[model samples]
Target: MSIKGAIKGLLATLASGCLAAAVGGIVVYAHGFSALASLRDGPLPPVQQTRLFADLAAALDGLGVILALLIVLVAGGSMAWVFLAGRFIAGPLAALRQALGDHAASLGVHLPREEAEDPWTPEGLGTTLRGLLELVASREADLVASEAHLAAVIDAIPVGILAVESTGYIRSDNLAARLLFGQTDPLVGKNLSALIAPPVHPGIPGRGKDTALDMVTRAAQTHETLAVHCWRDPSLFPADVTARTVSRGGSLTTVVTVHETTERRRAEAERAHHRALVSAALEASTDGFLVVDLDGVVISWNRRYYDLLGLDSDVVPRLPQAQRYERVRAVMADPDAFHALYDRLVNDPATTVVETMHLAGGRRLDVFTGPFRVDGVVAGRLWTERDITERERVQADMARAKEEAENALAELKETQAHLVEAEKMASLGQLVAGIAHEINTPIGIAVTAASHIADEARELAVAVKANLLRRSTFESFLETVHDSATVLLSNVRRAAELIQSFKQVAVDQTSDERRLFDLATYTQEVLLSLGPSLRKAPQRVEVDIPPDLMLDSYPGAMARVLANLVLNALMHAFPGLPAAGTRDDTPDAPREAVGFPGCLYLSARSLDDERVEMRVADNGVGMTAEVRRRAFDPFFTTRRGQGGSGLGLHIVYNLVTRTLGGRIEIDSAPGQGTCFVLTLPRRAPEVPVAAPSQCDASGTLGGDSTV
Candidate 1:
């Protein structure tokens, strides 16, 4: 039974017991049965006055007593039951009320289970409350655990997280959010604007600025995502924040999520810079370079590449590779050849291909083709073109010039040989003429003396036939014969000596034979042979040669050198002057001698160890600096049209140096005369020196020794 029902039953029993007791006491008082009540003066009834009256009185008394006792017992028992029952019921009810109240306060709900059918019963109330309290406890524990797990999940997330209220304050923030804002303190209850930059509202007109809280509120209301820039003192990070409105208990809170975009932005900027660099490099290239993918899609090209193919700017880097190739092939001089070459480059990537293309306007281009590689594998083809027309022309010109120079050199050598031989023959002819002139004088004298001796002999033969033999006639005949004979012998011997000397000098020059000979004697003999030419000039030849200076060398070359020098001096030193129209009737002897005293030529030699030093000098007109510089040039001369072959000194130089294995030097100055110094070895070379060209006789005479 319920506590209320039990209490009600107890109260009803108590009321009934009280009523019975009250009735019994009334009966006793009315019948005058009690001592406290006075006996009523009322008469008894007829039947009751009889003999049964006494027995009836006894019965009534006993029954009255029994009933009184029973009523008392019933009342007392009912009271006791009411007190005990009330105590038990009241204790449980009070306890249940307090427990329900405490649980309702903790869980924020009303007390008691509203869905119970008999909540007034003690068992029902107790059972309902126990189930409610147990459910509340389990749910409370689950709520606590779920909250802790949620907090853990939010904190563990990599991206920054924040829970903000509409009041512009942060309700909560994760560790990442604190770090993103560069905050060390707790972020809860802090103003959102103070941690991050104020959000920008670009779409809002007239209201140019807004705080983070205001923007976040707007994002929540509009259910939109916001891009915000935040700074952590020295570092800046861009964040994408998403705001959501959470409604609970008729109120709203905003949940914000933050994501950083710094690295992504930096990567985009680096890619932009790399693209700019590639563009700059392509523009700066000199050669025309073209690149295409393996599928024949044009990937990159430069302006030069367009120019080489005669392509329009709009067509490059936009056309397919096959179309571009066809366009270029159409303009080629040999279209079929270009097609073959292009096919080879595309199909055969292992070998690099090169070709020279000749254009319609005589233009030449060197084109090179090779594979473009990514890592180790070929990905595409590369083409580079360069013009080579000018280079080829320059090479051709150089070759032609080299051939012409070779032909000219050959002709020069031939001319030089003829000049050398001509100079040599001229020298010999001069020697022969001078020797012939010398022999004629001696031969003429001998012939005249022999004729006179013959006449004297004829006159003596006639006188002997008449027998007129006398001492005076015989004596005259003898005197004439002796004088003629002596004249004939002297002249004949002189002619013979001249012939012998001439033979030796001529043989040595022509034969190039080496012999040991006295230099002093050779010098005297050469001077004698040149005497005929020397007599025409007013010059004195002085020889200061050492008589004992003997040399084992080519005497013929030596004799030619000496004769040329002496004849040169005699011919050049004295100027040809017209004879005086009339000789002075009274001539001063000293004046005549002074006027006729002309140039002086000197020849000298000395010995030093195994070499000989010979010098030929003349006091004649000297040479200038310009004339002395090219003194030994083969065909150089100052008097080109005046009988000068310019080979006199050249031959002398070659003979002394090559034939005689020696050196020669010259010293001269204007108005100071000239000198030729020769340094020769005592022994000549075994190899014969080649002869030079024949010469003009006039060229040898009166020529400057400088050449």
Candidate 2:
């Protein structure tokens, strides 16, 4: 497509056309001239008699036509040759132009051209043109992609975005920005808050009319960015937002990140409430607690901890950069003790210690120390100091009481021995009748043995005196005397054994060893202990104990309960016949002999799988309902006088209910026998000592149990 190539093609065509025309003209002229010469010289073609004018004109016209025909043929051949030459050259020139264009492009500089830069030339210019078209197309694609990315990023963020021009005109606003400002006009080219718009909330950005416009104007004038926080105060609760002016391609634009702080505010309030609860608990708690850092810096101290030691923030020592503080140093004494413990745990990583600290002011604390782990790594140490001072004091008192208790036990044993002796003496006085009654049989047996012995001895003497008896007869008579004497000794020993068993029955019942005793055995034993009062009953006292009945109970307490009830029967149930004449006597014994029939009954049964209930009912003048209500009360008794200690039923109630964790009920009416029904569990119950009781309370037993 270059001018040189076109000119060459034209020239070649012209040259070819000229050469062909010249050849054709020469050949045609040569052939015609030759024919003319041949005709003039040899024989001229006869001119026909074809009308003088027509013939002359025709001959001339014929000469002209032949010449014309010759010219036409030459022109036609030249045109064809020119056309062929053009056709042959045009395709090559075009291809050659293209190659030259590609080659020039590879060189990076435009190649020198002579044809004044042909339009269709195959040179660097064509490559430059193609490159320009591709560049323009790529720019269009990039512009589209950038717009898409900007839109995506802006919409994804919660904060509204905007771009502003130097003239304070809004260039663009994202969806969020438009919503916040209550403008739906795309906000572009609009002066923010300057033009007519809706009313603004207090917290809305640029709240006052023209305020935002003035701010933007000032910013443009000053060429500075602005940052501000605002809220939409449509409601009492406001939505707060932070707006920042950021530079975008040399222009300042506003971007806001919105936040609704209601939830965070509520959570903070809840945390405050929890902190208040902790503070209150610390204030009210009896245990002293402290929260500290790893270095034992006191972060928090509760009321008890401060109150007990007379220390508070006012009195607490403040010493910075010290290995240990004044208070802790004074308390610990050893400068490196805390560090030693800290190192012990830090080094081994699995050590803990419970230490007993004897602090100042004669106080004590059980301090437990351990490592604190944050994210499964040791970050600090936590120390819990319990004011076990009370427990220690109690333990000390208990030890002292134990020693005193041992002494008391010894004294009680001695006193009981003496009481036993007194009772034995009283018993001997009472048992004199029974002993005498029983001895009559032993005495008769002894007397009969003695008589038999005398006879035997006399026979032995006669045999010896005769001096004529054989050895066998003398041996037989001596054996008879020896056997009689043995019978008399045996009778005396039997009587002594009965007295001893009766005497020991009361003391032996208090032993710790328990036995499967037939109720009969225990009843008889208690009766023998109370042998002195048997004759007080006018009628025979009836005992109805099933032969096979057994029970589980502390027989010592049971025996005592039986004895007390029986003693009550003797003293209160029946009125003494004063000398069989007067209604009253001058004085009464601890146990008075009754003038009426009185009976004592003791029974037991397996109330359930794990327990037995024992009963002791006495056919004595029973108590009224009012008295029954307070029957177990210490020092409350129907028999106010006659040595009633009044602790019998009270002790029985405690032993059964507290010790056995069982219940005791009393059913009694005036003039009827009182029945003490005990429903006892066969297991022990664990419970702390109870609180002390107030005096004069109704239906109370014994002293308050230990708490």
Cα RMSDs of all predictions?
A: 21.5, 20.3
Q: How does model 2 fare in lDDT? A: 0.53
So what's the TM-score on candidate 2?
0.48
Tens-digit per-residue lDDT, 1-707, candidate 2: 54335435545432122211122112112211232222222222224211222432343443232101101112121211111122344454454445445544553424333456543332333343444334434554676898899898886776566565556577776777666555565768766444322225444455355465555555455665444333332333223434456786576675434344556668889999999999998778876666555555666767676555455534562434253354554655353775576567657653567887665566777777666687887655555667777898899999999999988866754554454444434434544555566556777898999999888778777877888678888788778778888999998787676666555554434442344555567777667656546664552344555565565545554555566666655666655423242222211111232233444555667767777666666655678878877776655666667666555555556556654467778777876656777776554354325622212335544344321
Give each model a TM-score: 0.54, 0.48
Runs of candidate 1 with Cα error greater than 4 angstroms are: 1-347, 352-357, 365-388, 458-486, 511-515, 525-529, 559-607, 686-707
lDDT of 1 by residue, 533-587 (tens): 6676545566778788888998988987887666655555444533232332222
Best by TM-score: 1
Candidate 2 clash pair list: 97-122, 101-122, 101-123, 203-231, 689-706, 689-707, 690-706
